[model samples]
Target chain A: MNKYDKCVQYILNNQNHFYRIAYCYVKNEHDAQDVVQNTIIKALENINSLRSIGAIRTWFYRILVNESVNFINRNMKEIPYEQQSIFDTEYTTGFYQPDDELMQLVLSLPNDMRTIIILHVYEQLTLKECAAIARIPQSTAKTRYYAALRQLRTGMEDCNERK
Target chain B: MNENKDINFDKSRDAYNNMAIPSTLDDKVKEAINMSAGKKHTNNRIIITVASAAAAIVVLFIVSVNTSTAFAATLSDIPVIGNIVKVVTGRSFSEKNDNVTINVDIPQINVDSTSAPDTAHVTAEQVNAVIQKTVDDYMQEQQSVIDDYKKSFLETGGTIDEWNQRTIDLAARYEVKYQDDRYLSLYLYMYMSAFAFTQDNYYYNYDFVTGRELTLKDILGDDYINIANQSIIEQITEQVNSDSNAMYWGYHPAGYSGTDPFEDTDKFTTITDDTSFYLNADGNPVICFPKYSIAPGYMGVREFVIKRS
Candidate 1:
């Protein structure tokens, strides 16, 4: 009926999988939903800003990543080092489908290295897409992605040897 | 290694699809969009400019589920450093840093009264009780925030009496001069809390003398409240600022946003007439005038705006 009506239907229909994908990054469902709400709100407000269909998910995701970073930054002031097991306590829910051991290993990597793994392997965005989404040069993304994979492999191997 | 059991990209994709985003968000989204329709289209409203409002899809799980526990632990272990570290660095002080020495000092805010309290026998709590009572009364309306603050205060090994004691201790740090009949420190506290002659009703006074606290009622009572309301009505004349929108006569029940604290006190004899000035300029007060009519604990200057340069 109207611009908002059409967009609303589109979002409602396609929301399920995207939300779970958001969950994989943010860990908390509420935060994921908050990120998504901000995302669609951005999309609606700047509808005219969009020029193509292919750009939709990445553009939406870029907004989510930015918001998520801000959320973490705002909350970082409240976190202490002693509660490192905080996430471990929360992971009791069977909702997580990521390779737990591998995911933990990947998270252990420095943030830059972890960002490369999350963008390329987990999100399944291509090299070009990853670079564009991360706002890094293509070569930089390529280098980081390879380094992240090597680190993940090394971590998994170390865990296996310990076992 | 079982190739299929190795939770590959394809299996992850299936699970991702199975987990649904909350469907209840539609109404909220619609409401936000509709309300923002005019503002966002023209870019007049302050849009989500800071990247904070946007999504940075990599949701790190650092907010650890035991957030409240950590917060609770912080209160008991590290008092000043806990607030300071969180304040300075945009990060919470880790529990490991709980080793920082915590001085169990009373949280005394400074209060510069006109002079040191002359009554040698009276304690700080007696002076602060006037302000604290009004705050306790105001919190009757702010029930929710009050409960939270009170709970936190109790949790921090703080008793209700301590807040007043601290306030008085803070005020004592200042010199409370007695001018005509009123205490200057107490008067300044009341005025500041009342929003500097214009706003009153809430216990929002921050003691500029020593960062102590005071309440509006501690300084202004019944007659003054009515006078302030009259003054506000005269300024806005017939129109008043309502909860939602500004409306003319017969719009709302409680006329005006409570009371206008600056209403001329020529007709009122409660405060301005009796209370002696102790702080800055010397003269008969016009606001809380009538030397005998003023109540104890209630104090303010009479209309002195006309006398000063």
Candidate 2:
């Protein structure tokens, strides 16, 4: 088989890893599928720039986050949290269901804040890695993480009060 | 799931593995890759083709057709051509028939497209269609003229078919030019062909302005180089003489070369009225119009043509 066909096999082998990264951001089965497809397309476009297959996970995740944001930008109109039904149902079927109030609070933060939280809580990358992925200073990444957690805490408090 | 300060990275990794990927993720990715590659290839080809085609290409501009009124400030109440033409055709321009002085830009402009007998997007396949249509129009317009020309040629004890053969033989040029004046003034330079460059003529006297077509014999004539240029000369002269005011009264010669006396010289006298001079193409002195005397009413068309004669 040719090199590209072999690369396709390698991609299939590591798809579960790819899916985890995609699912972390999109939070829906269908949108995760779309994100995976777009990441593959981006990989092939910059395959020459893919330093190693080892880095494919990191590279594909970066593409995923970027494409997910772009997709949301186009589809997002108003921040009516009532429209997040599909997002909620998608993870309910998964192994772990996240805190709904916490999810809403995190999502309500600005994109940069949400991205930082997802990278921190879900991806669990180091602060240095997050800074590199986001192209921001390490201190800035720390600030965003703290700010997002503070907002989530406030959101949890408000929900408890309402209940 | 973590009780300790350091959550279990290995367990978390394992949990991630348990999480299912979207169905057909592999196939979807392949399809997207192929599609993106295909799109990239096509876009690159289009840019390369356009860039190559743009080199020194003299395009007959097809100006913008959105000539209807739009919002813009102009200081003039006179309603100049700009107000009439919102966007000019990027190809051909008409001074009188088209009142809109539009800035034209035609990326696909060619002399062949301009010389189309029919006013359609002329392509290679459509060449035959244009040829047939032009032939039909030629027959319609010329049957009577041909019969007359033949009748006169035959009256002197000659066969008409030989003359008919000459007229039929005009297919080589795809256009027919004449100084026909069934009515007074108003000339036409009609280019009727799905073929190569034919002579464009001048009938400066008529509002139905046209360019004449010549036989291959007329174009190549006895002097091989000039048959092509003769028709071009006739067109330049026609434009010089044509204007709205002198639409009918202007003058254009019916023929060229030493064979046709009026076309041989730049002097406009009945015997020697050659209004053209010779010049080299690098802005070297060629044909310049001497301030010659023309009838007071007929000065609009007296053009100064500079060319490598």
Candidate 3:
């Protein structure tokens, strides 16, 4: 198959990963679907720019990350200070329980740190690959990953103590 | 507690794997793939790039597929049946620097006047002029916004490297929502993003028979407002009741406190005479609400397809 066909097959095979990652960022069904759709269209349109087939994973992930961030930036709104505090405290106290405590903590990290954790830990990408996708230095990606792990540990400890 | 044991990375992985994948995901993916395949690459493309020494104006024009003779020939080859309206990309402007990227595609509408007499009140020239002006004005506004953002980024302690690392994108494109022999509908959207992001959608509907713009009253008759209002309210209530994430401004789930301290008045009550709408493929009127208009921004743009009984 040509590069376009291969890229399409690759996307088809890994669509679930795309949806899950987008959902992690957007936290909603419709927006996640939109992100995935946009990513596919973008990837196919620029398929010729792919330097090597071996770099497809990192390249595709980079586009996906960019699209997700763009979606968030476009939809970002300022909440009232009172409601902001409520949301922050709710994250730490485990009020919104879509999943387990660890996943909740994972979701609550700041955007960059959360992206690092998802790409490195859940997606099983190397820290180097994560850095490439996020356009950060490898050292920065490592720093963010360790920092995220520390936060998760501290959060889990706080939950245990509360229980 | 052991760090590895406490984190329960396996459980988190399981949760990630077990996240509910929308049932329509497969179909959506196929649709997107097919759409990509169907998209035609712009021919006779020209890119005129102007590089500025300082942070000054950089003009780049990408003219694509503007040959009217070829277009006319293609239209003539196809046997004439009824009035035909074709929307094509007339010109495109694209500029990419370290700090910003702007891509805008200006659409031109072509009416096959040879096949059908110009009986409609609105001419193709008028519609095209309106579209061109709207797009031009929006692009200029966004370009200035980006320029100001770049200025402030440098004025602050932000270094060139930091500014280069961050990039703003502005894009405007059009989509033909629905078209038939008698009616045509187009949707145009402009999206601008830097630190703050904004998207605006514009819709145009035309009737070839009357040669005029299509209004809600024209489609639904005199009772257009009532018909649209009833359909939208019913849809909103059903969505809010069925999905926990679906939230409208004036409605909430059962037994839920609908108080929002940000605004005192209920936001959405009924459709107005100027409410935005487009025709669906089935020629049904689909009412549109801009993001943050009726509900939160996360809802994006809400649409309700009005079914005529």
lDDT of 3 at B182: 65
- DockQ, model 1, C-alpha based: 0.08
Off by over 4 Å in 2: A1-10, A52-54, A77-108, B1-20, B33-309
Provide the interface RMSD of candidate 1 in angstroms, 1 decimal place.
15.2
Interface RMSD for each predicted structure: 15.2, 20.2, 10.7
Q: TM-score per candidate, in order? A: 0.36, 0.34, 0.51
CAPRI-style docking class of model 3 based on DockQ? acceptable
Better of 1 and 3 by TM-score: 3
Find the candidate with the highest lDDT and give its number.
Answer: 3
Instruction: Give the better candidate number (1 or 2) by DockQ.
Output: 2
- For model 3, what is the alpha-carbon lDDT of residue B53? 13
Which pairs of residues collide in candidate 3? B120-B211, B122-B211
Q: Name the best candidate (by DockQ).
A: 3
lDDT of 3 at A66: 89
Each model's DockQ score:
0.08, 0.12, 0.24
Supply candidate 2's per-residue lDDT for B302.
38
Across A1-163, the per-residue lDDT of candidate 1 in tens digits comes to 2233345455655565446545655666677677666776777666544445457666666665666666655555566663356555644355443456666565556555665666666667787887777788999987886777677667767889999
lDDT of 1 by residue, B159-201 (tens): 7675333211011012222222212222322111110011111
